[model samples]
Target: PIEVVGLLNDLYTLYDAILRNYDVYKVETIGDTYMVASGLPQRNGSRHAAEIAYMALDILSSVGDFRVRHAPSVPIHIRIGLHSGPCMAGAVGVTRYCLFGDTVNTASRMESTGLPYRIHMSRSTVQALLSLDEGYKIDVRGQTELKGKDVEETYWLVGKAGFPRPLPTPLHIKPV
Candidate 1:
């Protein structure tokens, strides 16, 4: 049990640092579900979506090499999802800031339905990423009905300017 806790802690630490590097804020981490956001607490226009995408890629790549302390041969995997739209953000509690709105919920839906080791995003986020005009490989996942929601166009954030399309997975990663 301790090993599990330690593994999660280390992973969280890694993510916290990575989020900072991308100028994104680590909103919270409930168990294995880590939440992050940008363009809030200080608005940065259309950069939030791209920032998240980059951070997600970095995290997924770094995770490929992150092995458990108890089992050095085993690597960790995570999923990421993004939805770009206006949301209400503020310090909800005494010391905790939070985001509320359809955007936040939709983003959560994207994450919950995402596949491991991949970044699943909505059309709005794809549009936001395109705003920068920096070529990021996006594979069309086509329209799908999300949980409790109508069908919507979804896409996968494959890679960006520096990261290659279909990021390289370690040999340790295998099909389920």
Candidate 2:
């Protein structure tokens, strides 16, 4: 639908801005799906988990006010999944960069099985974040079978450990 397309455009623009504030890199996007990673190209230690977590939370907050162009009454929602691990990165053809490994697959599963407007994270990612900063608020989502992988623990990133504050206004690009 035209509305879905417009929503995606808006999201991509917002994502572009969000990406600038973090050390993460945008891997790729297929349709409505957007993939990103940190500690890649150059490793940043446990900080990658925190950076990704912040970006995910910012995205969730931004999407809350995002309206579909064709159907303003309809709300847009996205499910995000995060996994921290090693992966192989290389260029495929021309300027196309690709990431291949079980980490990517597991992260995809986290998103596929996650609830809309929420950030689902794997145990490794949570541990990484906690190790860096215990100020992150996360809740366990329990064990679930993730396709080829057996049941594994999952978590939901709620917010920073402290009191919630109003998020700054997100940059919106008017449709051309």
Please state every model's RMSD to the true fold in angstroms. Answer: 3.0, 6.5
Error of 1 at 176 (Å): 13
Worst 10 residues of 2 by lDDT: 167-176
Ten-residue stretch with the least lDDT total in model 1: 167-176
| lDDT, candidate 1, at 89 | 84
The TM-score values for the models, in the order shown, are 0.89, 0.88
- How far in Å is the alpha carbon of 126 misplaced in model 2? 0.9
Candidate with best TM-score: 1
lDDT of 1 at 44: 86
lDDT at position 144, candidate 1: 62
For candidate 1, the per-residue lDDT at 46 reads 80
Candidate 2 versus the native: TM-score? Answer: 0.88
Per-residue lDDT of 28-101 in model 2, one digit per residue for the tens?
Answer: 99998899999886789778898899888887877787777777887675788999998889988997778999
For every model in order, what is the number of clashing pairs?
Answer: 0, 0
